[model samples]
Target chain A: MKARGGVDWMVVVSRLVFSGVFVWAGWGKLRDPLAFADSVAAFRMLPHPVFVSLVALGVPVLEWMTAVLLWVPRWHRAARWVMTGLFALFAVALSVAQVRGLEIDCGCFGSGEPTKWSVPLAWGRAVGLLGWAIWYGWRVRGRSADQ
Target chain B: MREGLREEGLRMAVMVAGSLVLGAVVNGVRSDSVPWEYEPKAQRMSRELARVGIKEGETREVAAGAIELGEFAGMVREKSVLVIDARAPLFYRMGHVAGAINLPREGFASFLERSGLLGKDKSRAVVVYCQSETCEDSRMVAESLRRVGFTSVRVFREGWRRWLESGEPVEKPS
Candidate 1:
């Protein structure tokens, strides 16, 4: 397909990558709610266990929505932006956990495996995703002008 | 094209806001259904650990030089003490405190009931330990025990690693 205004191959590739990540993550959490709740508890930020459980349940829903929306051309830009914002939050949480020397799992994939927290790597990924969102926004804006 | 862009932006805003509101409402309702228990930070963990103590008939806590292996062996002979190895099952099967029952942190609830360990006398001491001091599995298992009304639960804060490191007795799986 001809690139829609500024929505070039890079944007499409970024969207696909993020969609796959979210779908895999969402499926993992959805398979085991209690495990996800335990992972959330490890963060120690949510003062209430009930709130942690709620977040555990809601996270998969959000991931699934972002994954599905990324594939739908009409919602791709919005999904990209949302996913970028969420990843930014993840980066912050992971950085704080590392700084505190917490041995808790990142819960990124909901597998309860401890992951190395690399702030630079996380920020780089966020920037790439954010770039895609901006490009898609520009493309959508250009397409609207033609209409 | 400009109009299309404006419409998409408006729709995106409305959708994002609507989803956020819906999420908040659902979470609020869910939170109302359960009791709120908080997980303390590492600093809090240290504070909590300092407050833990043992009373009579409790075999859970050990001094730095105490032999956990001997303790487990003695408990096994008594048949009164319940020893739960809170490490992952694979690790538990590889080696553990002698007579320690494997109850990996993830499946502890079911393991407790299936092992016929639950609803036992609250005063009866239960010892739970994972890999080491840094490991959170033991803490999780201890918390699970508390949730089920086990009043005499104790965590072997320095777990199997320290147990073996201290030249304490350990046994290969049968």
Candidate 2:
């Protein structure tokens, strides 16, 4: 019982950390949509300017909402999956850009000078986040079953 | 396990739909919905140009000097023009056209000193470029030069992409 309680506490802490990070990142990106779009455009993954603009606008909002949902115990299972999917996509994108030898800003937090984080480091961070989300998802599922 | 996966998938789908609607709403409410129309960086670049004594009337000349890759290459060969790469330091380090100096748009002021551009004659023909046609750092840097009293500044609108595609010689920092 003590072990189970400790596990639950760990999940809660992870949830808080994830929520805090996304909210901060989303708010920052929302403040400068054009700069964010420019960073996205640098990857050259998206072909259309309009689509890039839409992504620039959409991603922050998605992140903010998902972050909020993750904090809600009842919604944790669904939100965890969304966060995992998003982080996985980010990891893949960063890896692809690195492989292509394209130098680009991650645009994860907002727009700034040349990315301080190397491509490998950025991908690792995203993958790490995805792992946390997966763990949270499993924990939430187990909790529901216990109830 | 299968039932849980199905439930999670359905919930995720609903969340995705909700997020899309929310994003659309947030974007619509923001002033930057038009993208290019509201770049604060560009505005700052214009202001920086103004600081260097360029007036409103002279800005027309500043904006008119767009040049093609071939002409830019000619200027490089004939006039030995100073070529400025207005991209981030990392990108600049990765690769750049031969004899080009990096002076990214945001850090134009500091780079001006570091690149020894301030010591050169203002009348010397100068060319500035960035990533590609879609990128505006080249234009921004060109305007900065013009405003700083450079007598001749040309923006290579096609920028790095055209130069690379044309098989122009490139140099990476050693």
Best candidate, DockQ? 1
After superposing candidate 2, which stretches have Cα over 4 Å from the reference? A1-7, A115-117, A144-147, B1-7, B34-139, B143-174
lDDT of 1 at A4: 52
Error of 1 at B97 (Å): 8.6
User: How do the residues B63-154 of candidate 2 rate in per-residue lDDT, one tens digit apiece?
Assistant: 57888878788777665888989887877899998888898876567677677777779998888888876566787788777777788888
Chain B TM-score in candidate 2, rounded to 2 decimals? 0.67
List the global CA lDDT of all models. 0.62, 0.75
**Residue-pair clashes per candidate:** 7, 0
lDDT of 2 by residue, A1-147 (tens): 226444566666777798888998898788777778778877788767677767777788888888887767667777777888888889889989888876566778876555335566777888888888777777666564122
Assess every candidate by TM-score. 0.56, 0.58
What are the DockQ scores of the candidates, in order?
Answer: 0.23, 0.19
Docking class of 1: incorrect
Best of the candidates, lDDT? 2
